[model samples]
Target: MEPDGDIEIFLVASPGLESVLCEEALARGFRDPTVIKGGVTIRGGWPEVWRANLELRGASRILARVAEFRAFHLAQLDKRARKVDWGAILRPDVPVRVEAACKGSRIYHAGAAAQRIETAIREELGAPISDDAEVQVKVRIDDDLCTISVDTSGESLHKRNHKEAVNKAPIRETLASLFLRRCGYDGGEPVVDPMCGSGTFVIEAAEIAAGLNPGRSRRFAFELLAGFDEAAWAAMRGAGGEGVDPAQITFRFYGSDRDAGAIAMSRANAERAGIAGLTEFRQHSISDLVPPDGPPGLVICNPPYGNRVGDKNSLYPLYGAFGRTLLSRFAGWRVGMVTSERGLAAATGLPFAPPTAPISHGGVRIMLFTTEALA
Candidate 1:
């Protein structure tokens, strides 16, 4: 990997959700992404890598190409690692952490492999290696081919630098954003989360509407690299806030939850995201989801699936009652609901056509049901 024009990026996603990440990458202008078991790999320039890091709500981390070589043993790995251009990526003063893993390869000793790479980086590049360092260099050896990548995202994208308050089983920002995109949210119409827990969807929606980049408030490891371009990054940060005013947006975002504590957390999270005024929170139940006084909009909800003890039988009736309420009152509104259990979704019985597609939510296999306005 010798400073080629385009960089190879690995877009990591939730388990069994590689296809969804691929679809999202394609939608975001990634060309011919290769879908692997747990992630999608794409080739792009530095700008694309930065934009993907900032805009891609589904990716766990965006890795950049540092180097690659073919090594059959430890000696060969050491020789090849020493000959590469480390000055291009790592400064001699900046400390780094080296992580290595081997799979289906002759070199099966992960600890020894990591030690070799760390020694090479330290001695050859003069870069300090530390245990608690933020900069990480990853080495993967598979089938006698060794690949090296740097973790561009220091912290996971889900830690959006906000959300000081959270509730039990809170929805991840990436999953919530993906579900919203799947529900066809174009930042044009009103939205609601009847069972909104911490207002993840509502805040993401407001950010999308206000043209705020999801990654603007956070920092990445790439920003600390040797040749990091500060001017280019500033331009990229400024690009997200164009042509949108939250005040003029006609869409009225709302959230409601049975737990008052959840509402308080949701409000606080919204305020931290700077979209508190753009969204409304209320302590209410599913039965109170009357159609908005304005236009009929999408109602996206990630209700509990009763996965704990004593939760199954007790929560089923809540699902049934929610279904009855939607059928009786929300006749002309579009409904998008996510739940881990198919039985709980089937309990809705809102006459949905079928799931658009199933997505992974919080380590469980979940399906989504969408229904158009009732006739």
Candidate 2:
């Protein structure tokens, strides 16, 4: 088991947007962040873990590597799991849930391995075990090396704790932020989402422009950890560059949806996010999408695809209408559209430069089709 002073923190990113997340971590001044296969790893202690959960918009969840050891079999795993100083990281008063996974390990039964760790924490540390515990201990046994990590961010970071209303096929806030970054958005200009499902892009743009921390409104599992200092955490949360003044914001984000319910949901979500002043939502169809009266900005949306929503032939007309509206009316505005089918993206004839690597959304592989600034 490693000392609690310098722990390894892993930032879980969506599969295709690892590079974008790495860029975000680097820009945020995480120490020695190395992009790994599934996520980004950084060396830090409790403060760094808390900060990562509070500040990072692209990370889906944060994991703190608490301990690792070699265990060839279930008996060895039980012996070593008992030796870990769980008291150093987990509070006895707070209940925890233990989850485990194994790959190429002699201790092939993940449930059995998890049971050993759970019993150790219960007996050795006197911590209660519950299936619905807010704090989670994740044990991974891969190739005979058993690593224990704690899920510092509970309920995933995308919930953001503000969006109460969602339409069908809502985009996660983490993915929305990454997609915005991929579109070269720097929080400088206006953004418009023609098919805003629940105002995710518009609200995310507003929040970024306002310099609001994505995790400000949420609670984390780390608060229940052993070494948590309430005063210190409060200070850290308060000591930061405050968000932009709503009055000072010059460009407002816009979203329009044909469904009035979606438009209502967007408005409600923006208000709850405290960025309502920086956003505008209207009930309008794609053919009615018009650029706001300002300098050009990125126009982005995650529209329905054939795989999930409707028949391909029916959606082509929607895509075509969307493209024609953008090309004919939104000159000088760049465009980014997310869809699972290339043919649907092509039907728009919007001159997309190239599609990004596929991203899994709702069991469908989707790609972002982007175009250069419209001529």
Candidate 3:
């Protein structure tokens, strides 16, 4: 596997948002992005993989499929894994960890398969294998074929490395970006999140409107890989920040919550993300929520699902008031609400479209209910 040769790049997306991720990949000029069960796959060299990690907002992480071979049993897997040109990808000086998964294959034991690959890499490639290593080689054995891929993004793209504070049940930044896209946001208008916890939607929107790359502040595992060209990577990274000028921006993203602590956390998070000037966070209840001055844009929120024990009915009044406020004041603005309960969404009475497929977040299944611009 040559580093400059075309290879398979997979952009992992949260489940149920695969198509949304495909839209982003297509918009970003990735070639032939076909949506798979868990992510979008495109063919590219190491440079494309870096751009995917750096510019793509909805991708959870980028995986570079380095090698693949047919292996029926443990011995064959060991032989093929050892024959892989690991020197082209993995650095001998940098330690790596091997993780394996098997499905409908002769080599069913994941631990045993991982051990075989680990031994192969360690003995043949001269790279150290550690249980706690920053670089990882993923081995997927499915239906008698073994695929080896590298997780190019060290930390998940959601961990922008700047947000230091978080409120409970916060939406991941990647997920929030997709939800905003689903709401027809094109970075040209404002967004308001009434029950914004940690200000995920607002901060994400502000960054998007300003044309900032989501991975700008974070380091990636690709930087440690063998054959990494620091100068080339720096040029690629520099070109991405050539986005919309903040001075030409006319809209702002807003967030408000009843808890003052949440407001403070959102402000701090925005400041740390380099998006504070374009975003506003306030302490106010849902009943007091109002649209920001400017053209109506989007009203998206991930409110409490009331899934806690004996807490379902307690949130009805809150949802109802939130709905009434939107219908009464936010004319011409679209709404995208995230919740697990259909009844809770209905409580808003905001004329949402039929809910889409359930999206799993933090082990809980939620759906995004969208509406056209309010009448």
| Total clashing pairs for each candidate | 0, 0, 0
Which pairs of residues clash in candidate 2, taking residues 3 or more apart in a chain or in different chains?
A: none
Give per-model CA RMSD.
Answer: 2.3, 1.6, 1.0
The reply for model 2, stretches above 4 Å from the true place, is: 1-4, 308-310
Clashes of 2: 0
Q: Which stretches of candidate 1 lie over 4 Å from their true place?
A: 1-4, 30-34, 353-363
**Top candidate, metric TM-score:** 3
Clash list (residue pairs), candidate 1: none
Residue 287 CA displacement from its true place in model 2, Å: 1.3
lDDT per residue, candidate 2, 1-375, as tens digits? 222489889999988888889899998999988888788999887899999999999999999998999999988998999999998889999999999999998889999999999999999999999999999999999999999999999899999999999998888999999999999997999999999999999999999989999999889999999879889889888876568788888889999999999999999999999998899999978888788998999999999886745577789889999999998999999999899899999999999978998988768898998888998
lDDT digits (tens) for residues 1-375 of candidate 1: 222358788988866567777888898788678899779999987667778888887788888876888888898888888887788878788899988999988888888888888888899889999998888998999988899999889898887888989887777888777667777776887888889898888888888778777787889988877777779888887876643777799777899999999999999999888888789999988887776778777888888877776686777888887888888887667788877777788787777667745566666667777787754
